[model samples]
Target: MNEYQPQEQLQNATLILILGILSIIGCFCYGVLGIILAIVALILAQKATKTYAQNPEMYLGYQNVKIGKILAIIGLVISVIYMCLVIWLIVTFGMEALQDQELMQQRLEEMMGQ
Candidate 1:
């Protein structure tokens, strides 16, 4: 049976964290993928915490786990905010399009009458 190792767990957590950060940076080019990475990082961080709790004596990577968690959370929040802004912009544009159509119709009617 493989024994639990703190260093290994910490390393995994750090990798996840890095991936999450990179994902956030990539958000400009790949929005949905970035959000997925953030969520994966968050899950890995939580796993690291649980491992630490199970083996307090081998708590070598607690700091790494904490850092990973923070990065994941920040990335996730940023992604959510970006998505919300995009949705709002789309809705606003649609409304503007409808208004433009109405104005164009009114103008056409006036031109015909005159």
Candidate 2:
């Protein structure tokens, strides 16, 4: 008779999930924080995947890793787009214009020939 061993939860699965969620929310913060969090989650997910592949039956929570990786990818894309937009704004409108909403609006109107 063979004794059964309990399966362990994959390491970093929960952390990855939390980071994935946070990365999306962090996108509003200039996209830097979101990018950081998403990168970390992706790295951890990759590690978890390798671990799971080595012994599929020895660990659980692979689903969380998958979900986290998907979410992280989404967050990363969104964050990159947002960052690009911010950089474009800074480049199109001088930094001083960005400091003042009224100035920024005025510049936009001028550009629009309003």
Candidate 3:
């Protein structure tokens, strides 16, 4: 017969929690890393849940897994939104810069009597 292991369950939960936190941090600094970490966190959280199910006494582990999953999802969503916003800002500013350059050139030529 197999015995339940609280330490192993807790360890898995901790791993998931760490991945989730890393994912959130990555979201602010790097989108690709954030998405990858979030995905790994999600998978680890699921594994932790299964471990908790096998050992019903590990309530702390179960709670950690749940929190990890939530954090992972939040990180992934924020990363995507952040990337989109960055792209939008870049495009908007690029167009504005081009227009400004054209205006400046026209003014310079006018001043030069050309």
Highest TM-score: give the candidate number: 2
Ranking by TM-score: 2, 1, 3
Q: Candidate 1: what lDDT?
A: 0.69
Assess each prediction's global lDDT (C-alpha) against the native.
0.69, 0.94, 0.76
**lDDT against true structure, model 3:** 0.76
State which candidate, 2 or 3, has the greater TM-score. 2
Worst 10 residues of 2 by lDDT: 25-34
Runs of candidate 1 with Cα error greater than 4 angstroms are 1-11, 94-114
Candidate 2 displacement at residue 41 in angstroms: 0.4
TM-scores of all candidate predictions against the true structure: 0.65, 0.94, 0.64
TM-score of 2: 0.94
How far residue 104's Cα lies from its native spot in candidate 1, in Å, is 17
Candidate 3 displacement at residue 83 in angstroms:
1.3
Instruction: Residues 1-114, candidate 3: write the lDDT tens digits.
Output: 988755544557877878888888888764778888999999888776776777667456677788889989988998888777767645645545435877656655675894
Q: lDDT by residue for model 2 over 1-114, one digit each (tens)? A: 987879999999999999999999998888998999999999999999999999999999999999999999999999999999989989999889989999999999999995
